[model samples]
Target: MSHEQIQSCIEECLRCVQACNHCFDACLQEEHVAMMRECIRLDRECADLCAFAAQAMSLNSSYAKELCRLCADVCEACGNECKKHEHDHCQRCAEACFICAMACRAVAA
Candidate 1:
């Protein structure tokens, strides 16, 4: 893939990482934190994966595509979990996750 294409994916991954982290923190502060356990867990997982994917892409690693594929799956799961919540942070995180998933898919393909 061209550097530009990889750059776009990297940007998306970074954005997702920020969104997931923010949501994870916000979820912890929710009135019913227990109810947001899944979302919080997924947010952490997704953020970590996205960060890894971004770093791999930055290094132009041979496994970047593979990592991106995994990242896409994690992003999708996180997005779905976030969508279940009514909080603004959750909604924003969901949108970021979905967008990042698409970007990851494109890079993987």
Candidate 2:
């Protein structure tokens, strides 16, 4: 990967991680936290996926595309979940997830 690509991936990954963490925290605060279990689960998964994608891009690994695909999917899922909540944190997290998803798609493309 080029230096620019690595930098881009790092930024996306950091954003994703923050979003996921925020979503998880917001989920716990939801009135229906039980219904948000899947959301929280996917939030954690998305965070991990983003981290892996960033590492792959930085290392210029052949698996970067596959990792990017996974990252995109998880970000989409997390965004959908966050959209169901009206909390400011959830709204912010959803936006972050959307941005990361777009970044992942660009890298995958």
Candidate 3:
């Protein structure tokens, strides 16, 4: 990928990371937060993977594609977990994860 393309991907991954963090915070404010421990965990995992993917992309690393693919997988799983809840934050997080997963999948090697 060109520098611009890599930068764009990194930007998107950063956005995903932010969204996941927001969602996790929102989850904590819910009355059913105890039931959302796994969801929160997944959100954090996805965010970390996204950051890793962004780093790989930024460096033009040989593992970029593999990291992107892993990021997509984790984002999808996080999305599914978030979707199980009906809160507005969960809904928005799920959408963000979905978008990030699609983008990562499209560019993954």
Candidate 4:
């Protein structure tokens, strides 16, 4: 049902937020911190968007779909950035972002 779908999307968004947070922390600990500047920024952005999307969905807000759309965009961007890195945390974050983007799209649809 619609409610279930929204709940699923919220769960995915939360997972993405966790992954992004992990990736951001891992990136900061990388040897070449300067090289991960963009990755860190995108990770932060994606985490924030995912959290917002989850909150909006939980409240059944009028703008939930709009937030989901933005969340998907940020997730995709973060995934792409994480994909460029070789770290295991980055790889995991990328997968989470991709999955969350799909879940968000389902909600927006």
Best by lDDT: 1
Clashes of 2: 0
Q: What is the lDDT of residue 79 in candidate 4?
A: 98
Model 1: runs farther than 4 Å from truth?
none
Cα miss at 59, model 3 (Å)?
1.2
Off by more than 4 A, model 4: none
lDDT of 1 at 18: 98
lDDT of 1 by residue, 2-69 (tens): 78889999999999999999999999999999999999899999999999999999998999999999
Q: Which candidate is the best by TM-score?
A: 1
lDDT-based ranking? 1, 4, 3, 2
lDDT of each: 0.96, 0.83, 0.85, 0.94
What total of clashing residue pairs does each candidate reach? 0, 0, 0, 0
For all predicted structures, in order, the TM-scores are 0.98, 0.87, 0.89, 0.97
lDDT tens digits by residue: candidate 3, 1-109: 4666567668878888998999888888888889999889998898889988988887879989888888999999999999988888788888889888877876784
In model 1, pairs of residues that clash are none
Query: In angstroms, how far off is 10's CA in candidate 2?
Result: 2.4
- Model 3: clashing residue pairs? none
Q: Is candidate 3 or candidate 4 better by TM-score?
A: 4
Model 3's alpha-carbon lDDT is 0.85
